[model samples]
Target: MNLYLNLPSYGTIPVVNSKNQTPNSNVLTQITSTTSPFITKANGNITIRQSFWQPVPNVIRYTYKYLGNNQFQRLHTDPHSNLITNSNFPDTVFSNSVTYSGRLIGLILESPHEEEYHSILTSMIPIAPAQSQNATGGVIDREIEKLLEIFSLQQVAIPKTFQTDEIIHIVILNPIPYQTSLFHIHQRALKGTYCTLRNNVWKCIWNIPNVRSDFHSVLNRFSSNDILINCCTSQLQPILHTWLQNLPHTSAPHLLKGHHPSTLKMKGRWYQTIN
Candidate 1:
């Protein structure tokens, strides 16, 4: 399905991962010798994993300066038509991955930077095997994800320009209905396993309902994943951080707004995107 018939330079369509490969391999390779005389052999480049287990990043967070707000904020969807009632919320305010991830630089390796919703929804979803056939669903998965994000933006985070918080207009939800629902739907989109594996298992797997990354990130805004507890989370932050940095970047950034205290101490480019 990674066919390149159509050019993707000018954003004609979402660029896709056409390569038929997955990172499921639990591998440990050691370079003992080098055949090329021009190249020097390096042993530290190879990773030494104790096991093949890939970390299932703890994306959900429960920490919050405040919780659900039914007060001055509007939690309901668009009344007349769909539109964001409040534009000053932190997702649009702070301009990074939101304020929740400020202290997670240490745990980032164990838990990826972007939530599951952010990962799948921002990018064009791969066509499901059944959907590709068009014998079943009408809409594609990516559209479903995008629409869900737009739909839930107001539920957890109040859309009103002015809100209940003494500090800010946004509200943080303890349990993100939007994110949980999406995780239930598309957690295994890129790589999943059913009870049975057929010849086309790899081709068509990630067929689930959708949600946006931002909405879910808000859900996790006040979550417990923020505290920096290296004694508890693990000491392997460096390797995991390296792995995450290597993940492919979407061509266009959503210009996500995130502002937090600790992020100031870190280095390198600061990318803020909704996805």
Candidate 2:
């Protein structure tokens, strides 16, 4: 698993440790003596990297194809009976067919755990549906405005508190792109010549990855223009859903989309319709 963080503007830094927690007298002195290494320094520019697998809906899109019947099956005298015959059990031929698996896209972004309150409150209000809201007009404009306020504030605070110009940004990627990357599962099946020769029938399964390495390549970076708060598809809007749904009901939030991960589970927030 990989954790990628992008710092939008990270000029270098002369970093010092905040303070020591509980520690023995000798250990405390030793830790303080250790020098803090300085890596890359930016003026406010940082790249982003890191990855985490979220159990997202619609992880894949699937389609299947059918292959025509085998020649032996067509020629068999007893059509319903087994295809294997004394002379051709080993010689049976078959055509290969395939079906496409699914594809998933993920994003990585950063938020201040502290200032997350206002957006948390606002996001609960929910988005209007695509048709009703007609996001190109005023309604969409208002939502985006609110979101930018929250995220921009967080961006500004990061450098001031950390004494570094860099801050973390989101990095999204699919860790396992194909079924061949999955682990294997084995099971018993009715005995056939090939089955008799083998211990068991084995199948492969792919579980989501804990993290992917591609997230690291873009660490600590984002474009100032790209960091809009209330924008529809990019960073803030999706994250608001993720965070609000995770919060407690004392928050009393509403949602804009019935399809949001939280709303699907039946929660208290108002459902926003995205027009």
Give Cα distance to truth, residue 177, candidate 1, Å: 21
lDDT of 1 by residue, 133-219 (tens): 121111211122232233134422322222223222222111112111112222233223311111122112111112124323432
Q: Which stretch of 10 consecutive residues in model 2 shows the poorest summed lDDT?
A: 199-208
Models 1 onward score TM values of 0.18, 0.18
Worst 10 residues of 1 by lDDT: 127-136
- The positional error of residue 179 in candidate 1, measured at the CA in angstroms, is 23
Q: Which stretches of candidate 2 lie over 4 Å from their true place?
A: 1-142, 152-157, 160-211, 220-275
Alpha carbon lDDT at 178, candidate 1: 17
Best by lDDT: 1
lDDT of each: 0.22, 0.21
